[model samples]
Target: MSAVLASVAGAALNIGTNPLAIAGLVPIVAAGLTFLRYLRFDPEDHPVSVQKLLPEYDFVIIGGGSAGAVVASRLSEIANWTVLLLEAGPDENEVTDVPSLLGYLQLSNMDWMYQTSPPTDSQYCLAMIGDRCNWPRGKVLGGSSVLNAMVYARGNKRDYDAWEAQGNPGWSYKDILPYFRKSEDNRNPYLARTDYHNSGGYLTVQEVPWRTPLAVAFLQAGKELGYDVRDCNGEKQTGFMITQTTMRRGHRCSTAKAFLRPVRHRENLHIALNSQATKIIIDRRTKRALGVKFVRSGRNKVVRAKREVILSAGAIGSPQLLMLSGIGPKEHLESLNIPVISDLKVGYNLQDHVGLGGFTFIIDDPITFTRNRYQSINVVMEYLLREKGPMTSQGVEGLAFVNTKYAPKDGLWPDVQFHFAASSINSDSDQIRKITGMRDSVYNTVYKPLGDAETWSLLPLLLRPKSTGRISLKSSNPFVYPDINPNYFTHKEDILTLIEGIRIGLNVSDTPSFKRFNSRPHKMPFPSCEQYEFDTDEYWECSIRHFTFTIYHPTSTCKMGPENDGDAVVNPRLKIYGLENLRVIDASIMPNIVSGNTNAPVIMIGEKGADLIKEDWLGQHFRKT
Candidate 1:
């Protein structure tokens, strides 16, 4: 049994070096893969052949990601309007469907594998490889949704209201709540019945079907600390609850699955996978986006968009595409010898939820998830046959939104978000370390010694960061990767806020609920911070700087605001400020970063952006709400 379990673990991690162990699990592995294949786990729902490319389409959307998928699907509902979605990567496969393996998906071929270019004086990400952090954006059809842990959070009500206050009309919580509901098909009976949530939508939102005892204990601990255990996505944002995921029947339901698959039969919608859009063919004199130039199958192709061209290429890709198409800052474009078109701030105002990664709490019991404990034939079989097992878990089981001292006292808005993991970073046999770009010395000294011990962790993420970053063009070449400078912890207040968050997390772990299992902070101090006494604010601050982590929620590069806002790249209607018939409809257009995981809000943006487009072309009567 132990040998079989080892084989299963080896096969699952794809690091099985033992020929004998691999040979023993070949049959089981083969059967599971074949079963998933039979279920059509691949995102081949749409039959889009290269030969089917037409001379022109009414709308050319560059990217088949979270927002692009929704935009393409919704626009194609009109029979007369032709929509083309060009994705840089291929369709998702069975490997991406398994929720438990979310971490492994990063740094793989499916990920864009972006690395941040931290300034020399930056104190954060010090322990990472080359003093840089890995930014794993999905390169698949579903984009980052295919790579994320499937946390379905819409952020605080004030987040959208703030956007409206920032001169973006029709973006308040009340105004956009319908759009959130329009795309949600909530599986939870209670939430589905609420006015805030609805049923019979394209996206499936529900609690993770399976969780460990530690996850339940996490909620109890939150309650002990005077936090509510109610729905975090519903009436109140400041509370604790089991994580709601974008999943269906224990499988990851990416945007491509939810939005694109249903409309695959639409003759007006065409998806071009592995088509990298190099530039937006714009009429300079008219300032109109005419078409898109993309390369597919080693061939260059330009397709005309009769009406509009939309960039739904996410925060990173959208700004990069804009800059490459000569729509960035005048000075920066001139430095690269590219003629400036719009001369707007394309990649400024970048923000992400930065957190501390190695804050682990040890427990006496063996209840926490570890690769060795759950990687067995029975577990695999249960997931395959019944879609119920540890494999269904997305690792993140519980969540809490709490207000720090820095947060405003008038509202329920939280400045800190806690992600409760059933297992610690050390539980995955260095997979987290590899994905996060942790140095060998740090992982070997701090986490490696833990060796799959029963442990849990609460990752305290700064929900509202004061420090902003930017994405800049590396060269005029569209194929060249852009430089991402997250510039985390640049503000002293940001560090202070995170320190308070860490204190709250520690307080939760010290509660009676967690104390029942004899839970205690892991004693190993980070290598660079060993000089300071452990558990002190000084020590923790140093630890945070060394282990600074990105929650993968980069946004606000092409900020949406009124025309007078100097930093605004897109107008309130999501149209490019200085151009006609061009708009950015992804997370890039966020005026400010939302308070939680960005996937749900990004999908909402797509739904609302689609309506905005409809109103512009088909008149105001075409609006849904």
Candidate 2:
């Protein structure tokens, strides 16, 4: 016999070894190889480090996050200028590079690990710890991008036109489209390269090279329901399509990798990891930002900014940092005993997509991700070699934006979004626990047995919530976490809208394409919502209240508006009012939440904000000449 056969036969012929025993070793060997590949792999070429201090830089960007990475990279293109990027977490390791491993990172050290304040009587997030939903924001260099589902969605054109109407000049759909196009590098040959998409840019936008059969069925179901199969990021978003991801060759192409890694060797740029900004150094007399005071290696250090300080620390961090720096509501600051500076509404307008998650469908076909070990081994090797397989799916395989009855007939934006996941949220045992932050008791009682079933799920997302919320200072100390109160479902209309969305999601399953799978509703009632009958409107309303949770797209805490608008914190150019040499350049500056995932829009904001800053300085230089 050959050497391979000889070894196998020798093992099988051992004193107590049966044929079944030898077969089991094959799977064990394959699993061991998968684990080794996951641990030894990393995609980043240049991971930055914290270097010695610089006395000054022309520009200082706080939070080496999604937008900050882009801003620092763009600003440093000028060889004469020096830029500094401060981040609170260390670099991403092998664990963060594999896209499917995203679930495991939330509880890791790279997460900020925030949670919403407990609801008063709504019973929202009842399944989570202490009745508060876990909010995991990435603390690493790429920030939330490293932790997000990696879907690339740009909101409808009318969303931007409304921004212009709200006193933000030059921000209409026509003006901002170029910036969006300028940032995308579309790699999917299947998608039509038109005015809506560009082929050469920094960020890679492509369809997942591999997808589950259920995801393909979802697209067919959309067509069966008489909806157009169109690109969501294209002219219309009313239909369903495979999601384009912020990934390159099956790995996450975070802003840190796309923007920062390629430019880290630039002589004038410096990155500081594990450095948290405690305060913005503002000269009280002149109302000008001078530098920043931060905590690094357990020692406080101050660094100067010669020109301007840009805040791209995201919605929660940006607004909280402003409040800590004495730049929020006067009464709240007084309550905390912090001296008041600019009394801007730093954290008043919190918004996020509230999703209702109980809608699931049991399918007769075993087409989901819950297969046996041999099939999983094939998927692992496929991804390892060709960068293709179910491993490329971003959990969310398809997205649909549609106007519910709540939206105006002529309104240009959709109020509800449906996210299609190929696998059942409850069917994945350890994954559901990590993704949802459910208590052990809740997980064991409600979701553990689901592992034995084959199912798919659709999450109805409230894109335009009538209710608004806020963030507040938990303590004046910068190290203390901020108190986030999304105040979900505060308005009764929100609950009603989501109920309509759930009805729509159910209606989609009645189509011929879905019927082929022998689909049936999996009606699992919540303990808190059991008072109402199954599938009734009352039951769904109760379910909406009980299971309502965020999709992690919070924005508008430092809202942009005209100069004299009372609620405005930043101006049309994103400059903070009553402050000189300072601006906020992240999603927090959005006047209102966009209609889709906020990552693509935030990257566009970084592109436009850099142009605005450069334009202003160039104007000053020309005037002097």
Encode model 1's per-residue lDDT on 226-338: one tens digit a residue: 88898898988999999999998788889998998887888888899999999998888989999999999899999999999999999999999998899999999999998
Backbone clashes (count) for model 2:
0
Model 1 stretches with alpha carbons more than 4 Å out: 1-49, 623-625
Best TM-score among the predictions, by candidate number: 1
lDDT by candidate, in order shown: 0.87, 0.81
TM-score of each: 0.95, 0.92
**Candidate number of the best lDDT:** 1
Q: Model 2, 483-516: lDDT tens per residue?
A: 9988888888888888888888887777777889
User: How does candidate 2 score on lDDT?
Assistant: 0.81
Q: Which 10 residues in a row give candidate 2 its minimum summed lDDT?
A: 15-24
